[model samples]
Structures are given as structure tokens and as C-alpha cells.
Target: MSDKRPLLDTSDIESEKDGIMGAKESSLLMTGITYKSTTVAPTVVWYGRQLLVRRKLFVGLLVVFIFSYFLIGPADVLDLDNVDSIVQVHHQSNVLDREVNQKLLLPKGYLVYSNQCRIVDLDPYKREVMRHFKRVSYKPCKQRLPLTQMRYDDHTRRYVLSINSTAFQSYHVKNVLSCCYMGVERVSESNVSYTHCEHFKSKAQISNTTDSVIVKCSTEKGQIYINGHATIPERLQIRQRLKQWKRRDQGRRVPSVLMIGIDSISRVNLIRAMPKTAQYLYDNDWFELAGYNKIDDNTFPNIMALMVGYNLSNAMKYCNPYVSGGLDKCDFVWKLYKKHGYVTSYGEDAVKINTFNYLKKGFKQPPVDYYLRPYLSAAEKLLDGNVVLGLPHCLGFETESEHVYNYALEFARRYRNDSFFGFFWTNTHSHGDISQTSSMDDYLKDYLQRLLAQGTLEHSIVVFFSDHGLRFGPTRSTWSGHLEERLPFLFIWLPPFLRAERPEFVKALRENRNRLTTPYDLHMTLKHILTLSGRTGKLETLDGAKDCPQCQSLLLPVPLNRSCEDVAIEDHWCTCWSYKAINKNSKTMRHLGERVVHYLNDYVTSFRNGSLAHLCQPLTLQGISAAYKARLSDDDPSQTQIYWLTFSTAPNQALYEATVRYNKSSTSEDNVQVTGSVSRLNSYSGEADCMNDFAIKKYCYCHHKSG
Candidate 1:
């Protein structure tokens, strides 16, 4: 083992460095035209819009346009200082979709065209145009860089470096750009290809100890190239370093937990809205709990259940947050992980209207090591990008889901090796117009794939879940919609090794796919994971753990016929039963219909917000839409019979639905009890619009009359 490594020659190193630096000047000159925030109308024609022009003349025209754009100001052009404002203006104008080809004639040998600037390419080989930034450079051990792509001259075997024609917009700014030289010898022929340019960008050295060589050098321009070769031993060292850089925890057995939650998405709708993510989870052996039920309505109650295994009603009864009882002392599942030496963090996109923030007084201090409330405030007030939580309402880009995905990605990247529990809940996409979430399918797929590719999820239990279904959309009016409201999507991705080692557990999870489950079960699963990692550090052993009273881990057997009552699911929210529609004129329908109308009347009066006048005196039964038979005593059909009915009420002429339990005989005895679950499908008039501002407006049909 005596001196097996080869030594590098100084002469070779000197020549390599010289080739990389090319020709360095003592002081750099900025002669080429530079434009900062220039608004160039695409129709600006250089050289009379000629398809083909002399290279010399083309270059000269660029110089003139550069002077006009730099020295003078852009004429008759709208400034895009606020991207959203400009985009909104575009959105309002029908011309945004008119697809007008905007041409900005510039002096350039190669032609590039965009909707913003349309150019006719004169070159023999026209290239495809891409939207994102080109060419990204990073320093050693730096944070993740934005995804970038640069134009390449395949014939010249170099990067296209003309400042006027460069697509590297970030290079326009000194701070956003960096200079790097990769010292390499191509191993896998595929690895050397940059056709998928992001592949090249991803290979950029993100850490100080990475195999790829990167350096910072002062230069007058943005484009630079690397020139270097390594000795045999150096190449081996580079390989080792590359391998190590890719894996943050190469041999660690401990697994981390990363939960990315989407608000107001049901299991069925999750598949519809995010098919790519759904397929990805399925393809990767991730388990999906199809019957995952919500214990209560809205984000706060469901989140309370997921975090502390307690519903909002229970939490309010004991340590109520509405009464200023801080959740810092609450026995949340994250607290257990924190107690076991794990870093716990929580984040939600709309912190102003966050489940705990709006429903109750938010935490006095951060409940976790890293809470995102402050960041949300800063992002909303200071920075505006792909995601913006605006005032009154959190207005965001359609790519807001991707923005939240990036935050979670950053967290996982930062703490890849640490035992951590991080929860990220995003409401920007699904909370309001759930139709926008359909576009997030590919975004989510890409995010999960990136985590898997970067090895961030190798030692983690990742969950992509949601609170409940679309709560305020037209889809919420259907019978299936009512059922969907109680069913949220739950996808869990376990480490490959664990799944392979414990096939029984994986099988159990797959078995529980159609079995009824709840967020409390998720809590129980997390608890099992935490407890298994006791003093022995043996997490693979998950035996002898008892299931909580109302929750069962998906990793364990869950009885297929598990009732809603067994899982503490309130009767109103239960959708595990079969139902049949009775005729509108049927005796049962008449009784149930009357009960529903009376229930709506009582509900309106309960508000007492001056809607008493609007309250119905002679409640006309327009029609009974549908009815589902609920649990009844078979011994006597009249003994406490519950009928779920969708009927309409009058005065306000609004449509309402309710589950009413009543006992009616041939004599038509008026003994009816209204169930707590009452829903308003449609409101015809503003008569009962006073309670529209309230969160519980589903039950409020009262209008304030101003004298």
C-alpha cells in the first residue's frame, strides 16, 4: 500500500487553468449593449424585418438597439414591474389569448422568437425556445439554485456567449450569476449529455465537497468555460465525493417524516385533480388509504385530529384555543417526536387564515423549531413571486402548489440526515378554486421525483395527504359530493428497504386501502414509528404496540367493516352506509320532507339576526330530491327512524338537505328530531345572506334587516 496514488504535474495544471480562464484582462470592459428592465415592443424591426441579413450588419443593428434600450427609454411599452399586475391586465383583456405574434427585431445572427418578442430565425437550423433562465453557477456548499437552462452551440462545442443573444437572463444581474469550472472525464456517455439542459444544471456543485469543480472569479461578462483534467487518483476521489454528495445519509437506519398536506381535496377528487401524483405514488409502491375519513368539517377540526388525535370539539371542551389557551402545551404528535430528539417544523401557505390562526388565537411563540407564519408574513408583505398570500384573500399563482412543494423540498434537502418531522400544508391551490389544482398534478409529481432522485426521501416516510374534499364548489351539492366531503386522500411513502424487509406491514397497509381510516390512524402510525425508535434504535421492529382507542395504524390490520361510531366519526359525517331514494310524494318522503323544512326554519331563527321576518310561516315543500335510509330499529320501523333527505324550503326559496330522525305513525304523530348535520346546497335570494360572512354559514340562513 505504498504510494499507490498518482501525482499531478504542475505544468498540466497551469495549462488547464489558462485554457479555462481563456484571455483574462487586468480590467474588464462592458462594450456590448445591456438592457435593464427594458420594455421592447416586439414589433421593433431592425433592418426592415429582413429574414436574412449580413452578420456584420446584424451585429451593428444590435449595437444601435442596445443604445436605444440603454441610453434612451423603451417607447410605448407597458412596464412589467409587477408581474401579477401585468398578467392580471393581460388576463382581463381578451387579447391575451389572441395569440398575436409580437416581433422585436434585433441585430442577431441567430433568430429567437417568443410571445413577448417574436423573431424570425435566419439560421439554417432553428432551435426550440425555452422559458426559464439559462446557465446557473454555484459556490461550494451553497443552498439549492433555481432551475436553469442555457443555449448551447453543438457545432462549435461551446456555449453561445454573445451578450446580445444570450438567454442567461440571471447573468444580467451580478448577484444571480456565478462562474464555475467542472473538472471532469465523462464516464457514462449519457451523463455527459446536456440535451435535457436541466440535467446539466442539476449537476452543478451544490456542496463544498462535491465532485464537480466550481470557483468564483471576477469577469466583465457572464459566459465562461471550464478547462481541466484530473490524475487517476483525483478522478477516483471525485467519484467518491460525488457519490457521498448525492447521499446525505448513506448508511443511516433512522427514517425521517415529511408530510405535505393539501387542504380541501377528497380521495376521489385527489385522483381527478392530481392524477400524475396519484400515479406516481402508485407506481413507487406508496400506499393509499382510500377510505381515510375526516372526523369533522373544515381545516381546523381535521388538523386538530391529525396533530393531537383530538377533534376540535374535544379540544375546545378541554384546552380551548378560542379562549386563548395556547396550543404550545397541547400534546400534538410533533411534540412526541420533539421529545425524542427530533426537529419538528410546521408550515401553512395561508398563515393569516391558517387552521389554528383563524379559528383560534395562533401560538404566542413558534410551536415547532421552525414555524412558517413569520415567513408567510414576509412573503406576503415583502416578496411577491409565484406564490403570494394577499390581503383579505390569499391570491396566488396557479403554480402556488409548486411553490409550496419547493418549500417542503428545501426543508427535506436541508435536513436530509436529521431525524425530523416536518408538516407543510398548502391551501393556495385547492382552498378556493379547486379547478386550478388540476394543473398541480405534474408539479407534485416532479417534486416527489426530485426528492426521490436527490435521495432526500430514501430515509424518510413521506406523506402526501389532504384535510377534506372541496367544501364550497358546485360539486359539493351532489350525494356523492356529501360522501366525498368526509373522505380525504392519504398517500404514505415508506423507505424501500423497510417495505422490502417487512412485507407483512406493507401488505397490511395495502389491505387497509379500502378499509375505513382517519387522520387519528395517521397519528397512531406516527406514534408507532416514534415509539419503535426507542433506546434500542431499532425502528424496523414495530411489534407489541397497541392501537389507540379510535385509531388504527394502516401498517396493522384494520377491520374492513369498521363502523363510523367505532372510529369516533360523528353520525352525520358517516358515509359508510347504503341508501335508496324514496319518491317525493311517498309517505316516508312527506314525513322526512316536513322534518327537513322545519329544521331549516328552526336553523334560520337560531341565527336571530333579523331574519325572523324572512323565516317561513307556511313552509311549502317544493320537492324531495333524494332520501337515504339511516340506521333504524328493525323491531319497530317507527322506533327512531333516521332519513337523510334533500328538500327545498321557501320565503328564501333556498334548497336545503338534512338527516332527520323521527317516529311517525298512521296518525301522523309530529315527533321529529333534527340531526346536527344540515347542509344548504343552494340559496336563491339575499334574504338570508346576513350570515354569509360566518364560517358556519351552511346552517345560517338569516338576513339582517336594517331599519
Candidate 2:
């Protein structure tokens, strides 16, 4: 025992360093033998080397996969850069059925017809029939188009030209329905007061004088029930009211030029509202010297057409408003007085904020010295006595109408002596706060009467119109407004200076000038008034009118006969767009861009009809509100797209489903969050049973109790 204790010397030092378990194991092994133990070191392994050997396959595969995604994947598709070139297969064409005519939504009076003529089917005459002159509708077809059909029509003949202007017997497709007269009343010797005409049995008065003229018109398309459900005429009735209107205007002097700028306006309503405005504009004493015709009923395109002497779908786009030369850019009127070099102005609040933006691309700032820019500078350039085509904003609510009126009056008073070219007034006074601007119509009548008394509209050709109709409906709400808001009133006053060409010109204009006109025809109308003949949209610019391209307006609408033999299917193989074609041959993803543009063009229509239905569909909003709230709260914007789909309420079958896989920055487990959205092109209720399907099968067989 004494020897063992003595041997427990410095050995304990190394013993302590090693674990007690290791020392015991060593002692146990050395127990029976003569132990000659010594401390020794063992070799260790590097983690990097071992790791490389153990996961060599995984590392190699990951690198190859990443390289494949960025490099090889692109090569496999059409070789291209950006979204347009990526080889994406759209298996379904955007072809549609039961398509509605766009003209149906256009402002009232506008119409669309086929450009081709065919033989009357039911008629035994088998004579050349131009059903093309009627409004667009499904009709039976039996035309074996002759070789002459290959030829393009003249540009000036672009209007729904009839093989026979009054082919009443060839009423192959009768769209003409009832016609209406606008509400009008002479408020003064020179001015007029107007309102919408609710009934056909109303007396009206108008005059041509040095003061302002006003007109108002209104109409609605609704089922006319006899007792309760028995409806009157199903289609619109085209009364022979044009003849009466001609008689009213025949004795008057139409303004040399009339400027109509409907704030947030469309074309159809303009047609219904035109009679009152027209009667006032052409009253005997005004510029009545007019030789003008109307083009189409659309406003923006019509105006542009009137300005540029080309169709809305003109091949050489861009109506460079500032340009002085070239027949292509300038309408006949502008071409006539390019040297007059008058400025254009938009002092009236009528110019929509987005108007200029839509006119030019990336116009975060105004386009410098642009052709339309002159419309903004017209009031300033009176010294040189230049021709001016000017429009000023008619802002309200913030600014008093009287103040704006007086301000404009001051400007006109100063510039009356100049040989002015053109003018457009916003007419803010016509707008209503029927609740606030003066509850009583008498108040507005009197206020307007006072303005007339001031006699400021003494000299110039004047025309008045509202871009919209009253917001009032059957029921009254403060927030109540018209669906496609329009203020339908236009008045015009013209001076004696342009009076030289009155006799013959006034007669033609008195008979036909007020027909359906596009805003594009405004320039054409002005030119004709200036005694310069040109054709454009048939309006003032008849001298500058041009043709639309063949492919655009031509639609192969489904037929009424419903015979498979009646339907013609042509080769669509040439329509197959190859990846190379998109990448190299096409213009800026030509095919893809066109589809996108079409989708955009048609998307708004869904909102006007389908989306509204979905939104107001008592069940949809109640069912999906939770989902929408959840979706909108998301920090990511992409999540909202799905929410939109839900709000759109697209049916399961209607929705076009797509799944995109992307690598994320997380080094954790793979997870996916399901989302939803509806089509912008078409509206439908989008629903699902299993949202988080591991497989992106967009189909659903179950429905949750709505919300």
C-alpha cells in the first residue's frame, strides 16, 4: 500500500489530462502485463477534405443545374433576350364567340357596317345589295365575292357608303330605330337655353346672332313595357327627323367652324345631343357660311382624323400638331394656313390630364415643341394675326365659373381684332351642382341670362357643347352620376368676317353638316368653313378625308343562319409564330405585343359589364372579402394579383392557369403559398377547392361555403 501511494507521483498530471474513462480503459488493458506505457499523439482529419469526398456528386449536380437554367434553358427555347423572345407556347388562340359590336357601346348615333356589298338573298331581284350600310349585326351571307372585291375602295368613300344612299327596299339589315330631338329654347335674341328632351312632343326655338347659343339633348335605351312585360319596339327606331332638322337649319348661317370638346366624353351620346347644338350653331347671323360634312361618330379618332387628314388607323401615325409642312401630318385646314402660323391653346380645363400622356410615349414631361403643343400657346400669339386652334380647360369646384368666364371674356375682348384661326371653350358653367350650383333651374337660367346680357360673345364663331349628360337618375343620391357621364349641350356663335362665302356653302352645310361627326373631323370642319376644301372624317375636313386600312374594321362575324356551310375556316397555319420569328423577324415581339394590346383594349369592357356584375353580385363580395383583405395586406404586390383574380370572380373553366417556378434565397425547406387572380381580358368568378396543391392543378371539384 505504501509503494502504490508513492508511485502515484507526477503520473497523475498526465492522467488528469486524459479522461478518467480513457485512463481506466488503459489501466484495465495493462492490468496483467508488465506495462511500458508512454503518452503518444494520433493524426486528425480535415473537415473540408472529408466533406468534398462525401458530397462530391451533390456539389457537381448543383453547379450543372444552375448553369443549365441560365444558359441551356434559354438555348432550348427561341434564342432571344427579354420576355418577348422566350419560347412560350400559347396553345389556345384568343378567338372569341358571340362577340358584341363595339359600336353598341359607342356614343349614341355611331354605327358600324361591313365595307363589302353582296346580293340580296331573300329578294328575287338578286341585284347588287349593300347591306354594308347598316349597323353591324349577324346576317346570312351568300356572296361569291367577284375579282373586283380584291380592289380597295377610295379613301373618300370610307364612310358606310351605300351602293344606294336611300336603298330603303334593300333594307337587308335595318338598324335605324327612333330618332330624338334635343331640348332647346331661345333665351335671348342672340343666345339659347337648352335641356334634355324627355318626350318627342316639345316645341323649341333657336337663332343665329352675335351672342352665344346653347343646346341640350338626352335619350336612353331601355325596354318600353306596354302594360308590364309586353315591350314596344325591340330595336331602336330611326325617325325621319333629319328632314325636320334640315328645315330648321336651312335658313340659318352655320358657324364657319364649331369646336366641340366633351370633357371625358364618348361619341354615341354626341349624336343624340347634336340636334340642339347644331340648330344653335347654324343660326342665320353666325358664320353660317359652311361647307362641311360629318365623318364617323367617334370623337377622339374623329378629331385626330379631322386634324391630320388621315384615318384613326393611319399607317403613318403621329399628328405632329406643331409641324407646318407635309400633307400627311397636317389636315387640309392646317395645310391651308400653315403660314398663318397661329398658335393653339388649352386654357380651358377640358384637356384631360392623361390626354397628352396618351398622345406621346413616356411623356412624363410635355413633348417639346410638339404639333399639339401649339394648342396650348394660341392666346399669346395674337400680334401676328395668326390662325389659332385653341381649347381651354373648364375647371370647376375649385374655381368659380363666373371668374373663369370673366377671365376668358377679358382675353377675348383684348384679342377680338386679331384674325384668329380657331377656338375651343370648356363651358364650365354648364356643369351642375344641381344641389349646390343652384337647386332651381331658374337660377341657372337667370345667371346664364345675365352672362348673355354682358354681350361678350359678340364677334367670333361660337359653338357650345357638354362632354357629358346630367348625373341624375331615377333615384337621387348626392354621389349619383351617369354611367358614361356626358353633359350634352353645345352652342356656337360666329362673326361676319368669314361671311363672304355664305350663300352656296351655307346651303350644303344646312342640309348635311351636322351629321354624325368624329372629333377628328373638327379640323376638317374648320377648313371647310375657311373656304378650303379638304376631306377628313367628312366633317370640316371633308377635303382631307382618307381611308382606313382594310384589315382593321373587317370582322368575320358569326352568321345568323347557323349553318356549318355558312362558316368559312381558312388556313391558320401561317399564323403559327415560330420562336425565331418572334426573336428575329417580328417587330418588337410583334405577335405578342398585338395580343397584349388587344387584351388591354378589351379589358376595360369587362369592367364596364362583367366585372361590375361580379362585384355587385350579392354573393361574390360576401364570399371573397376575407381572401381579398388577406391578399391586399400582403407585403408583396404579386400576391395582390391573385386577390384580383378572386375579386374578378372568374369561373374555374374560364380562368387561364399558369405556374412559374423560381429559386428562392432560403437555405431551408421548400414551401409554396397558393394565390389567385382573374383575367383582365374577360371577367369570371375564380374559385378553388385545394389552394395549396403540390401540383398546380388549377381545377377544382369542391367549394367552401362562401367565406
Go through the candidates in order and give each one's C-alpha lDDT: 0.53, 0.26
lDDT of 2 at 174: 38
Task: List TM-scores for all candidates, in order.
Answer: 0.58, 0.31
Count of clashes, each model: 5, 79
Model 2, span 601-683: residue lDDT tens: 23333533543222221211111111111111123334212111111222232222111111233334322222111111122
lDDT for residue 627 in candidate 2, whole number 0-100: 15
Query: lDDT score of model 2?
Result: 0.26
Candidate 2 clash total?
79
TM-score, prediction 2: 0.31
Candidate 1 lDDT over residue span 433-488, tens digit each: 44556556666778888999878777888888998876654555554466667777
Q: After superposition, how far is residue 419 of candidate 1 from its true place, in Å?
A: 0.4
